[model samples]
Target: MSALVARPFRLLGEGAVRAVRTALMQAVSAWTADWGLAPALVDVDVHRAWDGTSARALAWNHGAQSNGRRAWLAVGPDVATGLQQMMFPADPSYGPVGSATPALAAAGALQALDALLDALLRTSLSSQHNVPRCGAAVPATSWEYGSGALVARLAFGSRHFHVLLDGPAVQALVPPAAPLPALRAVDVAAGVADVPVSLRLQAGTARVGVGALLSLAPGDVIRLDKQADAPLTLASMSSHPLFHAYLGRCRDEVAVELVQSHTPVGEVQ
Candidate 1:
């Protein structure tokens, strides 16, 4: 008995796919805008391999890197036709201006396709960090496909077209990951040595009715809730208590002597 095994294939990461889609959309938008056309990206997909079924495709050979890595771009027939119609809109009164019109339209479409490919290459290569520099493009007689490729669908009005990339091109569009910086031990005290912070001391607190507060005279005194001999709180600017202190006189100036550490609730002794 013979058993069949599924072949394993490598696919682009989600980030790479997203980057390719964005680059395509930007390139298409820029190209179409130059020709006074507005187009929207409909979808993007990655295929394991080209079926070699699409005929009359306009292709170009482009390098994704200076190290002889080659890639190919192909515009489907429908896309070429769409580009022709878009670049040369016919008047209804004239209605099919003759056989020469198709020839002219095809020529114009070819030029547009070349420009579009240039724009795509520029967008894909320039937008990424750590990506290898690409070389100039040349006219390709045929397309070579490998394990994977990318296909992006774009729509202008009701018409839709496809842009295809070979495996190398898809791989080229993916940027290399940037290396992370190495971690080293830092001096905790030295790092914050220059930072300024404010400390405060709390003598005591008193409560009184609003009426009594408003009726206070020049000599009026409010009794505090704490006893006179009780230690005051040494706190941060935000009033978070840090230590207990006792009132004292230092060089004819009133001061507080830190008596004990103030442990906050839920902390170990």
Candidate 2:
């Protein structure tokens, strides 16, 4: 005895769904005039399986290198009858020959359906190596149900129908993810190493009234905000402090010895 294992149903991603929907809508809109039928896309979705009991379907295969991928376009009884009536209106003068309406409508609709399949395949296989082509119509009963498939609902002159793409067909439309570039260590100091930057040193500051400042004469002492023992701030031209330094003498000339690095509040070192 052989054991049967059930596989989990995989739903189509958002990107794949959008792509199929857009392709179908575009194809219908483009060929509406030539098709002689006004078509509109109602909905596009994913379904586990298609119920073929009460629906008539046209099956086709397409692939880049081989015609192994399969898809189906199906319509309910009402849609089929509507298509028959639309393709062959009642001609009372031609009495018995009117019985052939169903067959004639099916044959005529095949061309339009094939065109839709071509449009979908062209869009999905654009990035692939070989251009995809649709094979001749196959028997709908021959189509094997997969774990899940994409189903598109379309309305043509009040008649609604469905287009289904099998798992392999849906996968063909999904674009491959691009590879990320390799990461490398960056030289933190190389780019700015040669750039010139101007720095300033601030010894102390004081706030005085305009009158008092104007009245100040030579030899008059002005008190500063900083303590005498405090180190001065070494900053950039923009007045951003970079370091703390103490005023000192180097070889009898005035100099500043860096005591510590200065970091502004709320700033990382």
Candidate 3:
């Protein structure tokens, strides 16, 4: 019951499956056009089927990684046979296949799958919304192809195949998403204009026995771990080191001249 209830949510993209499916199908169609092989995507979903497992597959790390990705392809006995018949130069029945079944006859099937996946990825990148697509633009070089690891089980027509993409390969396919309803600009000066902070003048240090410290009088001085004339560290109320300053006197009052900031310039106070 739990698995049944969770499957849909796991597969569906916040009720955006239709849109995602359509986009993926379009991308696949554009690529299969070269071979006149329309291997449509019958069903697609994101899953953790091969999250950390490695298997015999044509998989390789692709581009820089920023997120997770999984790609599955399934080609059943019949579909595998059909694909082989159409794509391979020599018939499956000829040469070494001899008496093997269609599923077993998918000779050079890995190469075929590699080409299909590569094409789909390129087309997918090209189909990005408003992303420039022209002769000057190159289809993304983000796909890392190799053999090992089962990432997905593709279901298209009557065929079933297991395809996988490593973490890096997935990164190539999906770009980092930008925040939606982008943050609006606002004046920040007023919010932090007047804030109280802890300004300390850390002099020097001296370690003494408890007995020696207790024996001290009002005229005694306990040194700290700092040095004379050393820079002072100003800390915020939150205990965050804020800045380094130099002890000085401004006009007639003692003050500290800010010497260096502890954080980046644009960081909020």
Candidate 4:
């Protein structure tokens, strides 16, 4: 009875999904143009399933072989049969598994894919999945095959960079980020002769328990844990450190400028 039920929506959705996959496959070919791979050698193919899953293949560089042939390129769902997949698979099987044809060398195709992945990972459409000892599974959104298991498996491909599996996965690849500016303090001065004792700078007061507060009496000193030599900190509304300067007077006027900062002004340390 269940098998006889209508499943039109599922079928329609799967068809739409495959159409989108085909479009993305074309985009992959255009995207890899920077890799300078021969377009003639590359052939993008699409495989769709009754289930919502789909796979796209691009032959980056392929050629005839003694027995079989294969295609290679930047994007594919079947990492096993896909050139890049064969080279770096989550469940790596080095030899052969499926059909053969004029295929690209899995190793060389991977090198190109590696560069592209590095870029894709920087973007939002990419994800990395650790497939145990079989290396990493770096599948870009263009390589998406409509599986929650596949998406959940994304992990960081390279050791460096903020590239990750589930974070911002934008499709367009952006350049690597630059290093943050270092912190620097402005002019600072400590005690000097004849400075007004009552003019001593004060840090923000902290609240204590009711019992502790009531215990305080006139002439009773409560020494704070803050070090006396600690630079006076000025913070912006954003909680970012703006500057650090010692309390001092320059001809009856306090002044501060570039000296050294625990962190750069206007910059988060």
Q: Pick the candidate with the highest lDDT.
A: 1
Find the candidate with the highest TM-score and give its number: 2
TM-scores of the models, in the order given: 0.41, 0.42, 0.31, 0.22
Model 1 over residues 94-173: C-alpha lDDT tens digits? 65546544576788877886676666655544433233324345323223333445555556545554455555566667
- Model 2 worst lDDT run, 10 consecutive residues: 57-66
Better of 2 and 3 by lDDT: 2
Stronger candidate by TM-score (2 vs 3): 2
- What ranking emerges by lDDT with the best candidate at the front? 1, 2, 3, 4
Reference-based lDDT, residue 140, model 4:
45
Cα lDDT of model 2 by residue, 45-163, tens digit: 43334435333334323333224455554545566555556656777776655555446567666656556546545543333333445444534433345444566666655777666
User: What digit string (tens of lDDT, one per residue) describes model 3 on residues 1-269?
Assistant: 35543211122232232333344556556646755665553444433332333333423323211123333333344655545655554665666557766454375555565565554444334322222222221112212232212144445555554433333343344445567996878777766668554555544457899999779998877877777678978776665777898878899998888889998997865
1 or 4: which has the higher TM-score?
A: 1
Off by over 4 Å in 2: 1-77, 82-173, 183-185, 227-229, 236-241, 248-255, 263-269
Candidate 4 residue 99 C-alpha distance from true site, Å: 32
> What's the C-alpha lDDT at position 189 in model 3?
76
Model 4 lDDT tens row, 1-269: 46664311222233433433344344445545765544433333333222243222223221111111111223333432353443444544454557763255565655655554443332224223311112233334323333211111111222111112211221112234468998786533333434432212345466578998899899977766566666676555556555676555578787543245657444433
